[model samples]
Target: MKPQLAHSRDPEMKSSLQELLIYMIFLTDLGILTFGMVSTDMFYLNKVMSSLFLDTSMSETGNTNFKSIESVDDFWKYAEGPFLDGLYWDASDIRSSIAVNGTTRHIYYENLLLGVTQVRQLKVRNNTCSVYPAFRAFMKECYGPYHYLSEDKEHFGLKNGPEWWYFTSQSLSPWHQGLVGLYSSGGFTFTLPKSKNASIDKLTYLKEKGWLTRGTRVVFIDFSMYNANVNLFCVVRLVLEFPATGGVLPSWQIYSVKLLRYTTYYDYFLAFCEVIFCLFIFSYIIQESIKMKILKEEYIKNAWNWLEILLLLLSLLAIVFNIYHTVEVSSLLEYLLSNSFTYPDFYLLALWQTRCNNMISVNFCFTCIKIFKYVRFNKTMTQLSSTLSRCAKDIIGFAVMFIIIFFAYAQLGYVAFGSQTDEFSTFQNSIFTQFRIMLGDFNFASIEQANGILGPIYFITFVFFMFFVFLNMFLAIINDTYSKVKAEFSVMPSREFEISNRIREGYRKALAKRKLKRKSTSQNAILYAVRQDRRDKE
Candidate 1:
């Protein structure tokens, strides 16, 4: 793209140099501030939340004992103790409007929550599987609990692949049919009214449904509660993975508490940062639009054009997401506040906010990367670009060969060890296992135990071919390309290298209207009167 300037004040400086200088100065500041906003919002939220739930604070609340809620009894311990105490504080802002004889009910939890009293005394409350619509929808679709893309995923609570929808729904067997906490994607979703009890009622129900028994191997439980204190819903996930065949009751359990917060002060600042980045986006759009008008079909040939397009697309989405997050959070928080006594359902909003955060992160990354486009004047960056461009075809071919060979090995590994080895159980797992093997994270013993004869042969050959051969082949391709690029750059200056030199020449030209305008080596005229008479005579 040609950088054009109208009515040049300085005769020395090129238009491109001025553009790069301005672009770098303005865009880098904007990107840094935007990234900081994202980070700060998360940091503040986490800090406050940690104080409420972690370490010493939780110990004070008597919740430390039941922190790892891997079983039904552990959760009951938490609910009966700190959870009830927390509700008293959480409901402080939303105390009941209902009155007894022209006076507000002084019974806090009973008045604030739908039910917490029996015989004019506070009774322990119950917990239930989440009734959040989006959560149920996602579960109905048979999607698992966690979001991270991983190879070693275990859908301990939800149903599994190919047959997830069927086995989860229509063809569901007795044991897992109404498996209590998490059954189908529909799950054990019950109205969290007075009926939904937090005690071992669900476990008993699970036992009745054949999901839990004396000989059961594992069970996973997930539930949520509303906190009006922060206007956020916290979800608690549990895993009861201890051995049950030892004639002892399952004694080991694990739990994690996760929550997404409402918008913070920095969220508004983030919106401001979005607008700042918008200016840069607008500038690029104008540049690209002008180039497209002039170049027409030829504009499609430039890869930078595509990067600009992608950057603009992400920027637009980020702006929309920011707006969505703010508006949705405000409205949802209001709704949740009014209904603070009931279970809060903010799953979709949380998902969207998380998705928005992820987008802004990607947008900021692209914003930083966009700086490279303006700074191609640097020799090393130029060489790196050249090397990639030169080896693009070779790398593409190499990637194809690598995937084919890699997939072949993955399939073989799955066939040999998938049934017994957890890492090799799924196709995605097999691929990740191969990658991990190269990284020295694989368990050779597990592989051998899975299939004694094929295990050692598979491990050795996979390492020999992948680690020693194809992987090195890829590196060699890059090394050779970079060497050629280095030699070429050594012989001839890049087109942009002239801009760097021109920037040096335009140092004084770029002074603009600053106090030190156009630096001069001119001498000052020192005036003297009577004192100069002796000097003049001399």
Candidate 2:
């Protein structure tokens, strides 16, 4: 009774263990799927952000403590004052008027342009009040100010002399043809006012006219410039900061500015769903890893197992890097909001995130490859496995011979044709080109260009040997092995079950052979003893 109970309990334990293992495997699969979904979502979000940000035309407005000066009255307020005494001021005779209610007095200041230029030039000058300090900082941090200036000069060649080159060649577009001619041809300058009295009067008058407003007023300035080859129309915004008090000196600032691109609600929702999915995948990977009973060294020996581990590791790394990037971006944005003197440099974060996303995408591909292991359980896949396995040794031996000759040809082609043809640029490229030719992507013209007559001979001979002869040999080996494996598998009930049964039958036959040998030895011994007894009787 006790033995029966023990046997029953043992079976129950085995069944429970099997059930647990199944549950774990199921959970692991679920987790992997979830992570896959998460990775896809992240990729989608990245694409959306890239597209939105790349489209520089998309803009959003925000209230800033910057001033806007739309008319001559606003400019005169700062220009006539003692504020100009310390700073250089140049005005242009190119007066333009925009009909707001009536024609508002708009005078383009060349001195203002000079002032902006000088401030930019004086990199170490601390006293120079810049309206777009954040912009300057952002540019300086992301791309050095000098480098940015140099690039601008190089992009738009310095034809109109160094001092006025940037301003003159800045707008390259047919749309701003008249405006560019107006600004370049005529402009005015005024030295900083020696006293504050004159500037105060102008400010007071402008204040009375309701031009002096609190915070910043952003004005979009459009212009066009043409280089010899291309015309570019550009827009720049002016940030004007006017203080509440009339006597205080006002701020004038100009720098390149960009607005942060906004993301849609759908993007956020998708990201949220992805996060949940990724969590599940992460959990499953961890559990699967722990359930592995093999030693680390032994576990890594299996290619599929190693791949699984690698996928898990890369996913984790990607997730960690992404989290860090998100945090850094959020922190940077917060810093920008708190201190307007600083701006967000999303380049570093964007680049880092892009790299992580790319790695995750690769992991997803590998995961798909890993799924083939399960597919191999099918009867058709089993036959494929057997065929491939049987052909593997022969293929490996052939590959060794093939690689030597292939590389020899590759090197020869590279040395002979590298200078003349783009295809044979390097040994690696030569090898790839040969492979392409084998696949019927042969470019006779390009090959002929390398050595003319010799090129065609070399290409024809190489193709004849490698593609027609060697490749056919490779295919023949595979085809022959595949046929044999398929025929053998066809005779079997099931590949796996048949193999196990054959092994068992072989074991039983070995035991039967041993038993028969023992029986024969015993019978021979008895006959010998009986003959000895007869001799003794005689």
Each prediction's whole-model lDDT (CA): 0.52, 0.47
Cα deviation of 285, candidate 2, in Å: 4.2
lDDT of 1: 0.52
Residue pairs with colliding backbones in model 1 are 70-253, 126-197, 126-198, 127-198, 139-185, 140-185
Candidate 2 lDDT over 25-107, as tens digits, reads 54454445334333343333333322222221212222111143334353443233322322222222335222211111111
lDDT for predicted candidate 2 compared with the true structure = 0.47
TM-score, cand. 1 vs. native:
0.61
State the lDDT at 342 in candidate 2. Answer: 24
Best by lDDT: 1
Candidate 1 C-alpha error for residue 449, in Å: 2.2
